[model samples]
Target chain A: DAGVTQSPTHLIKTRGQQVTLRCSPKSGHDTVSWYQQALGQGPQFIFQYYEEEERQRGNFPDRFSGHQFPNYSSELNVNALLLGDSALYLCASSLVYDTQYFGPGTRLTVL
Target chain B: DQQVKQNSPSLSVQEGRISILNCDYTNSMFDYFLWYKKYPAEGPTFLISISSIKDKNEDGRFTVFLNKSAKHLSLHIVPSQPGDSAVYFCAVFVQGAQKLVFGQGTRLTINP
Candidate 1:
């Protein structure tokens, strides 16, 4: 069975630019969550999607948004990116209220 | 305020020795706690976890101890191997919020 998978292993963008990251959840999983891991820090929850709607979100600003397709794949979009936004974006998938398994993550570099 | 905290930024131990990693949280409402290990260029891999109702949970050579009164938990690895070296993160799952809050993470180095 395939585990959680993320697209575009790495990305480079400039301040004020926008970037999109994609993720295909693990097989048999329905919920998808996104996280950001800055240098020397742990992953911080961004938001979670279930039933094609965002069910929960973290303290992130409105510039960060996401979408979940019917197939359980999800996408994270960051607009007007800041240098501080440069970090590793991780995607995790799980069944309802179950243990989450994470993807390899996409390294976002804001120039 | 940081909900989950791993006070130790780094730890080093000789191979085949006991390695203990600690974590503390500020909230008492957190019912579930988990530990994850991450290597360079890879996402965190779930290690072990313990629920608030249980003080201890064990999986093979890995064990987790939770002290609810102290709002603290710990992960113990026996006979550490070099491959075990990585960054470990302590995370808490808020049932109401349905999200994972993570600590800053602790780097574990097992020297051979």
Candidate 2:
């Protein structure tokens, strides 16, 4: 019954630095999706991973990418971050076509 | 352009009164709609969802109404509680797509 869990509740990085965020989905869920929520904004989908492959993506740039492990855990990697990249990174999990359950989110502050 | 929009940035309601949050989408292709409640520093929690084929769906104190013709959706919370005060987001998806298009979110405050 454990819901989606994400690591590193908050982090600070300088511009041009690379950062990695991790997520472990809720038990019994398969699909994993990543989202970015700017201050006072709703989450914008980054991409979705199913069967270890990225099945869908959003309007984000190539600098943002992710990986899903065999255990259904996910990692979001951002390369050469910019100041605009500062936001709360959320991880959501769901069964195929089911409602997504979101984690607490990692607050990334790019200076 | 924002496909989904929640025009109201904030709303206040008295406890035990009805609270209505509105959302509108410009896409006619959206077939499913959902409402999510989120507290500060936490991710959104699913509140209610309605399919395009249905006009209304109710669960406990929450009811979601959809007007496909107008491309609008609404979430009603009856007998609102203080615990229900949070930012509410309206999300939409197409029939076959897994990605959701979300509104800007409305902050609801239920006063005691």
Highest lDDT: give the candidate number. 1
Task: Tell how far residue B52 is off in model 2, in angstroms.
Answer: 0.6
Name the docking class for model 2: medium
Docking class of 1: high
Summarize candidate 2's per-residue lDDT along A1-111 as a digit string, tens digits: 789999899999999999999999999999999999999888999999998989999999999999999999999999999999999999999998988989999999999
The fnat scores of all predictions, in order, read 0.80, 0.68
The TM-score, computed over Cα atoms with residue i paired to residue i, of candidate 2 is 0.98
Candidate 1 lDDT over residue span B1-112, tens digit each: 8989999999999999999999999988889999999999888999998999999999988999999999999999997999999999999998988899999999999999
lDDT of 1 at B12: 99
Q: Model 2, B68-98: lDDT tens per residue?
A: 9999999999999999999999998654557
